[model samples]
Target chain A: MAYALMIHPTDNVAVVTEAVRPGEDVLYEDANGGQVCLKAAGDVPVYHKIALRDIAPGEQVLKYGKTIGVATAPIAKGEHVHCHNIESPERKELI
Target chain B: MEFYGYRRSDGRVGIRNHVLILPASICASDTAEMIARQVNGAVSFHNQVGCSQVPSDMQYALDMMAGLAANPNVYGTIVVAAGCETCQCGMVMDAIAARTNKPLHGLIIQKEGGTIRLIEKAVRLAREMAAEASTLRREKFPVSELILGTECGGSDPTSGIAANPVIGKVSDALVADGGTVILSETTEFIGAESILADRAKDEHVRRRILEIVERYEQHFIRNGENVRLGNPTPGNKEGGLSTLEEKSLGCIHKGGESVIQAVYDYAKPIPTDVKGLVIMDTPGNDASSIAGMLAGGAQIVVFSSGRGTPLGSPIAPVIKITGNDATFRMMEDNIDFNAAPVITEQKKPAQLGEALYKMVLDCCDGKLSKAEALGFTETAVMRACNYV
Candidate 1:
């Protein structure tokens, strides 16, 4: 099982500890020794984010229990979450 | 809680007893470098600003130049200048004298007749200061006497999850022990301003926190530019930072969970009496940001770099830590601490923090950081406006 980490309880995504290939099982451990797993929908590089649930466009991509960005496209659970699918809302006003 | 350090005449403590060869303008930087090279325990960096700058911009350069010399890390300073420069050697020398009654010497290229003669005089001055500096033995001082500067650059996801959080633990430990810690890089605080403000020690600090963020944003907005245009740079993106908010949330971890007691402008001195965590308004550029903190009287700095860097300060030692095992393995020559085991081996961050705290104390006790050992004295000063 590939390991991942959820920095905060409210964070909607987790960071992979190592590169996970498509169809791999990404396991996340909690402080209480509890474990959660999600099957990787695609290749996710180490230190990259993976969605914990389906996210709709315009929805906040939560990490560290805060909005990192807004999803720009449909993202299924376990899908890679990166710049290609999410954009900074702050940039919209200026650019 | 105690470490060996040099106690300055100003009642401040310093980890290093360096003789600073300070260049007041760009024209004298080469001479300063040559003089420092000839003297043991002498340091100097290229100063690109000073001449041809508007008064406001020149003030920043002058403040940095003087503040650096005043930093307790320096045993004394030799201020070198070209006579025609806007930042005169006398002005900088006076600024340093105002900050502390430390030993100071001034020189001008025109008075000395050229670079060769100036270098000869400066080298003699620096040698005398270095000899005096070597005579003072280290005395034990409490860690509470230290003002620590925290910074992060070349960030990634692991930095937020591991290295920064580990630094957070150290921040809390230091603050709890009555030391001062500085959290800077206003640009990185863009999306996390509210979060930081909520932890302010009072309404004044709270309002100042928000004000600095607003001011930084407005400054960019007025220039017909947006901070998001360059933040979360391509490297940050590749390291899994998709937005400024994500990067900021990671960046603020270096401040730890302590309440912010005060806020300061760029390169201003951090008063010795102010304890606990404080915020310094600074740009996100690595070298310039570190310069601001060092000038603010930070005796030492802890810098977290996920991608790893070899950057060092001319005035103080910078301890580089990283959370990426790959980066740590690849750049061990430059990086001093490895926080990657918090992810790979599931080691506790607090445990690693304890180890890191020891390393910090060791650094204060005279251990040279990898960057310092390699003689990496990269320096830069913040500029408020363009040249006239």
Candidate 2:
């Protein structure tokens, strides 16, 4: 089965093991080591991120169990997560 | 726990014994290369900076040049200069002498009448030095004498998950073995300072960790640019890394879980008394960062690259490892090890780390790495500022 990898249980995104076309079902190992399936809502490049859960605008995007970036717009489950929807911020506004 | 290495007069063990044709300035670089080509077991690098600049910038070039010559990997050095450069041959010789009492000689292009004459003289000196270098036999040394430089570049998501973790395991093992490991690239530590500081051995190191990151970011911030705005560079973004934080979190994995014992300035000598993990303030640029570590006396570098790179050091062997299965297969000629099975076959990172550790031992015992075999000796030294 095509798969993605959820690096941490708290991570809202998982990295795709291979490219996924829209509507394709991709499997991912959950934090508990159990496999879960999600249908991709959009295409994602290989090694790119896929939304594991719905994310609202301005909310931090978690990967490696930490804030990798913040969403600039709504990100739906199984949607491709990348620069178009995210911004790597300075965290605390520059002094 | 033991590897065969050349025992230097300075009491340091060297994994390689090449004679170095040192260039004191950019003007002398080609001459150094020309001399190196004629002498077997001689190595030289293209020096981009030497004749320019403010005192601080000139000092960096001087330190790096001397450090490369003083690196235990070389049996001797023949410093070549254009005579009128800011970094004079005599100054470089003094710097090298401050670090090691190894065999040393100097030649000036103007004094020798030009490139051809200088190369002729340097080639003869290098040939004699190479002969002496060849006489040394590899002797057994404990792993504790080794300093491992850890770096990651051309990274993708797979690097953090597989390759860096595998290197992390090796870092931990080397620390456990009482060997020194250098965690460099301060520019990559932006979003993960707290995590690394948490692993510091004491308040001093923890404070230094924060200071170096602040200093690096401020250099950009003071110039009206935010480092976070552009990091996770174009290649990093294409490789699935989204933020400086994500990249940093991955980059820190190369340090394993060892507590940072100390932090050294760029191109400064890594004190021999220090053991375990230390951090060197360096840029994120692969060649420059690796060059800083090598200058600090690292005998070997284990670099993890998910997007793949051919970076190597002239003085030390750089063992390239990749976690991306496709990249490894595609760049088999450049990459030295593959950590892809961690994802493809679900093998443990620790297991792969043991295998990589053995490869490091083999490299130290005189096995040429892919980079060494291909003769990729790209190097760069970090500068304080532009030419004055």
Candidate 3:
């Protein structure tokens, strides 16, 4: 298994163990025991995250079972999830 | 449940025994260091902050100086003053006396006549103190007596993935054993403040946690700077942390799942009765945040890192743990624990936590850590703002 970890059951992202080249097979068993296998759509570098499922723009991106950010653009399964595609709303504003 | 350490006169326990040469201001710091170098078993850290400052900054300086003096790691303290600084020799000594009854001595350069006389007198005193400190022997003390400080710097994805969560487990274990853990760096709580507040035992503590996070945010906004710009850090950004929220989400895992009991100002000593997790409002700078916890009474510090930094304290043993196996192998001399196996499923968080807890005990019992073996001891007093 060119494996990745789904940290929290609520997370929609999986952090890859090593760099995954485009079109390579990747498997994920999410927190709810949801099994997923897909061909990588983009190069996912080591320690970087990938979408476990399709996410709509403005949807919350979950990691560590918490809201790490909101997606800036529509994200597909196996696509790389990075700063360019997400925004941290809470971190950007202060009361 | 117990480890060998030096039992202080004030009923506190210490993992190391040294005679500390404490400089009252930046001016006297060099002199203080010289004195420490001349005496074996003596250590000193220079004060880099300008002595003359506004009230709040002065308060931080005084409190941190006193905290370093009162730290259980020191067998005695010799406060050296440049004679005309805002923090006077006698006043600093009195402040330290209020906290710990361990041996303390005061010196003034002007009173002693000149640099030659001051250095001579300081060295003589330091040598005597070191000799006295050497005569002390380590005694076994219950682990419950421990006050732990937790911090992170140069964070990355593995910070949340393995390093910090592993520490969170250690925090829970320590708290379960009736010890105290100080979770710090107020800036890191920007996005995850509410999640942390939920872990507070009561509304009061929760409110204070939120309040400090706001205060830090506002402090930046008032100064016309975005807190996000410097946070998450360049190394953090490169290592897959996208934003401050993502970094903070990982950052807070150091506190584990224990309920926060109280919130404290930077450098204020934590009350002995509070045995669970506590938050000390501190800056994001690695050394400054750690210093705040040290002054607040953390006998040992477990610093989680991903990109890796070599920050150590003269008064506390900093055990650096990392989940980035590459960083660990690259900086093995600075890092003490490699928790990367958690991400690989080779080791469970609880198992690594137990192993780390044992390392903590062994460190307390005089197992020299990587930082200590390399003789890396650094400290800095965190100021609320720049000097006026």
Q: Which candidate has the highest TM-score of all?
A: 2
Q: All models: lDDT?
A: 0.90, 0.91, 0.87
Q: Look at candidate 3 and give me any clashing residue pairs.
A: none
* Ranked candidates, highest TM-score first: 2, 1, 3
User: Which runs in model 3 stand beyond 4 Å of their true positions?
Assistant: A90-95
User: Chain B TM-score for each model?
Assistant: 0.98, 0.98, 0.98
Kindly report the TM-score of the first chain in candidate 2. Answer: 0.92
In model 2 chain A, where is the ten-residue run with the lowest total lDDT? A86-95
The TM-score between candidate 3 and the true structure equals 0.96
Across B1-388, the per-residue lDDT of candidate 1 in tens digits comes to 8989999999999999999999888899998999999998899999999899998788888878888999999999999999899998888888888899999999999999999988887888888899999999999998899999999999999888899999999999999999999999999997788899999999999999888888878888899988888998888889888888899999999999999999999888899999999999888888988998989999999999998888998778899999999999999999999999999888988999999989999999999989899999989887777777
Model 3, B18-137: lDDT tens per residue?
A: 898998988988888888889988888878763778888888988998888888888999999988888878878888999999999999988999778999988898889888888888
lDDT of 2 at A80: 94
Docking class of 2: medium
Residue lDDT tens for model 2, B1-388: 9999998998888899989988898898998999998989999999988887789888888889888888899899999999999998899999999999999999999999989887877888888899988888998999999999999999999999999999999999999998999999998988788888889999988999999998888888778888777677788889888888889988999999988899999989998789999999999988888888888899999999999999888889999999999999999999999999999999999999999999999999999999999999898888768776
Q: TM-score of model 1 relative to the true fold?
A: 0.97
For every candidate, C-alpha RMSD to the true structure in Å: 2.0, 1.4, 1.8
Give candidate 2's error at residue B65 in angstroms. 1.0
